[model samples]
Target chain A: MNLYANDMLGEPIGLLLSLLIGAAFGFWLERAGFGSSRKLTAIFYLRDFAVLKVMFSAMVTAALGLQLLAVTGRIDLAALYVPESIVWPQLVGGLLFGVGFVAGGWCPGTAAVGLASGKLDALVFLIGAGAGSLAFAPLQPRLADFLHAGACSVGSLPGQLGISGPVGALALAAIALAAFVGATAVERIMAKRIAR
Target chain B: MQRPYWNPYVAGIGLGLTLLLSYVVLGTGLGASGGITRIAATAAHAVAPAAIEENAYLGGYFAEGRPLAYYLVTMLAGVLLGGFGSAFAAKRVAIGVERGPSAPASLRLLFALVGGGLAGLGARFALGCTSGQALSGGAMLQTGSFVFTGACFAAAFAFAPLVRKEWR
Candidate 1:
């Protein structure tokens, strides 16, 4: 049985493993230049598509890989945790996150990377996020209903569309490929305009 | 001189693999905001343990023992170490503020604080941030994640023009 499914590993060991995983995650993010707020914020300007390209590619890869493993009986998809689908909260929260992304030039993860790379602004951003989180704790009681709004059965695209998981994965991969092509085209045009 | 970053696609694949490993091994995906939120809880506990224990959000963290004992908190520490290692190897570690030439440093810092606060609140509302919800949930084909992803990019693009000066 897998560690996650059977509780083969204890909490201390599990947390230790997280360090290695988190390290790899951080390394790749830094290698992608996510440590630089300027590079990350460039996506909003349409001058750089690294954010889109990286995120979409990663999503497609993980989606396809997980489905493949599931289909092959190598892993149990059911055992993996999936976040609940709260539509209204997620949608509105996403909008707010996007605005903050453009304004702060960093998200929670990348901000950590940025701070590691000695970015003072990242430090300030972290502080603000901490403070905001503290503020949220108190406000959570009042916003409980709104946060739970649009509660639905945990949903997946494949399950909702009446398609197989592999098919859904393929569809997402196709979309990602098309988006990459389109994003590159837009970046080229934008760069040319700036040059002129 | 500093080294250039890897190709976006290559880095993307690496990130995807890392995420997959997390799922297979831990039954959960990567996260960041959870750790940060815990820090806030930890601080609140120090000030008013009873009050923190009574709160809905912060209370859950305390229920699990120490607020900082969660997996995400340890992972975040690793993120810091790994990020520093990579940046140091590439000679990219330097203390500075990154902003467009047209934007003043003070304005940029102020925006960062406000924007960070908004993002923190948003993450709480959604129960996840970009990494936890958008990336991880999207891979699982979760419908709300897609909605979150679509709404996020749409809103960002819509408001981008107003904040163009800050970045451009």
Candidate 2:
């Protein structure tokens, strides 16, 4: 399951709430300097770390929040759905996706915002995405086996790693925190070099 | 003047809350590209209704009637509108191409097209985009999502220098 209201047929929300949430999502992304291709790509060049910081911070925030809620028994953790494990396809697909992201300067969602915010490049990108999706149909059978390869069970993190949920969550947080700190140090050092 | 952004940490909390709110309200996480897929599938059906019915993947969304009535499509519409609204309030809205200083506008546009094509292609094989898979699924501690995120970052890092001229 997901975090929005839906009818039995499976819609996410009422139209109005959907728009409001989407706008907020877009607004925050822009405020974080995501609307700019340069800013987004800057992380790759080690010129800016906002993308990593924002993403990691968001991940930790949500993960920790969910973990806390699960512990408190406020929210039914089991009811909340997560994506299933599909290893090989995702690993290969992710590599391809990431390379595309650096080249294009925006992911699917951000590109939507980028286009709306008047980035012509983003518009072109979206069009390409459309074509690409359509193009995948013919090659489907060949990639089909790979796509479904490595089918591990769902919520397989702690179970697969042989740890409790809280422990796994904490470990994730610690790792993210370390990365955050390291990123900050690297940013400072890079800025100093640039200044010099 | 445009209002400044909320701090990254603060924004992260806000986004996280939105995500959490989504789970509480709808019992799932946030997603972006699935909406596109639904819409795209619906649109594709327009041209080939019979073929769509035959195709296992695209046919699933269209089995009912119009694919436009679905939630993901609505969410995506909201994503566009929301993004537009945010850009509007920030005065970040402008009509033009974005490119690196060293790159020509047309060249940048071309790269954007190719890059986007690859991403769209990759997202499907992965079963979702960064929104549906990585951000939403990652927080939920989904194995595939993490794997996907890892590959994406790894690939991006590996290819960043190769495509440096496109953005450098």
Candidate 3:
């Protein structure tokens, strides 16, 4: 019954839901070839558009779904937990993460799937990730300002862009559709180049 | 022979539904790095419990000295298990290093480590990785998620050329 388990622990139902949800998350990831590092990093090479296709579709789907639920009064949008929009850290972290993603060949979620599929490199990557996470402890103090800068916990694209939620969702969907088309074209071009 | 992977769009819908279900049930979305961080903290606690207890970034996870009890931790376990089941059924279970034709296994592993390290650091800085930030927060239309996603892809593309031999 306790939906907000972020600050609490030992909630049996919450933990159970976490397991089931994670199972589905991992299952779909593996199904989408995300368990393969090469497949994941293929986006960088413009060789495979699976990552883009999957990510964009997923984002649009969830965005619309959440909007529908909120609009229908089935769920309260404000109750959902979303991280604050801290621009500085996100920008810096995202840039670093991008490098890591391409070089490492897997993100943390996919890396777990990769490890499960018996990839030795995934195990090593996980060790490194753990070490890196631990490494952040010492630097947290110095990075506090940058980390918390522009912290807007409830900020959304719709609110910032001066549009309604549905409008924003439609715009994102449109963008994703265009991107998907572009992704397919890039894939074809890359495939042709590799073929020759 | 291993079966072919699912279509990206189909699998993506499945993933999205799972995320929606997560939000509906848990009032939150999926995550991976947070779990990894806690697991790392747990290991550190085992080695130097007192040190971890006082760690500025990690100390909060030790409130009950049971970092593994969190939702993300359980979710991580499920991710591993579910991935194994799917891969196993598809006959894709193989123990090996994934790298390009010219890259040595050792070199590939080194990249994996370094890359993973950077990703972990970045995830900590941003408070999430692809799962939490890009997918979860992206669906929520959080502005920073888009920024992070944009930055991540841009940086990856920028770095891809330098690491060309690794995946070519």
Query: Candidate 3's error at A20, in angstroms?
Result: 0.9
lDDT per residue for candidate 3 within A42-158, as digits (tens), equals 888888989999999999999999999989988888888888888889999999999999999999999999999999999999999999899999999987888898777557989
Q: Global CA lDDT of candidate 3, please?
A: 0.91
lDDT over C-alpha atoms for residue B73 of model 2: 63
Q: Write the per-residue lDDT of candidate 2 for residues A1-196, one digit (tens) a residue.
A: 4343224325434554555666666666776767778888888878878787788777777788888888998787777656777898888779878988988888888888888788989888877776667667767877778777898865558778888777877888898889888888998998999999
Each predicted complex: what DockQ? 0.77, 0.65, 0.86
User: Which rank order by TM-score, best down to worst?
Assistant: 3, 1, 2
The whole-model C-alpha lDDT of candidate 2 against the native structure comes to 0.77
- Estimate every model's Cα lDDT from 0 to 1: 0.88, 0.77, 0.91
Most accurate candidate by TM-score: 3
For candidate 1, the docking band is: medium
Tens-digit lDDT track for model 2 on B50-159?
88778766776666776777655666666677778778877878899887778888888888989888888888888788887888888888888899999998899889
Off by over 4 Å in 1: A6-10
Supply every candidate's count of residue pairs whose N, Cα or C atoms clash at under 3 angstroms. Answer: 0, 11, 0
The fnat of each candidate, in order, is 0.76, 0.69, 0.86
Off by over 4 Å in 2: A1-16, B1-5
- Predicted candidate 2: interface RMSD? 2.0
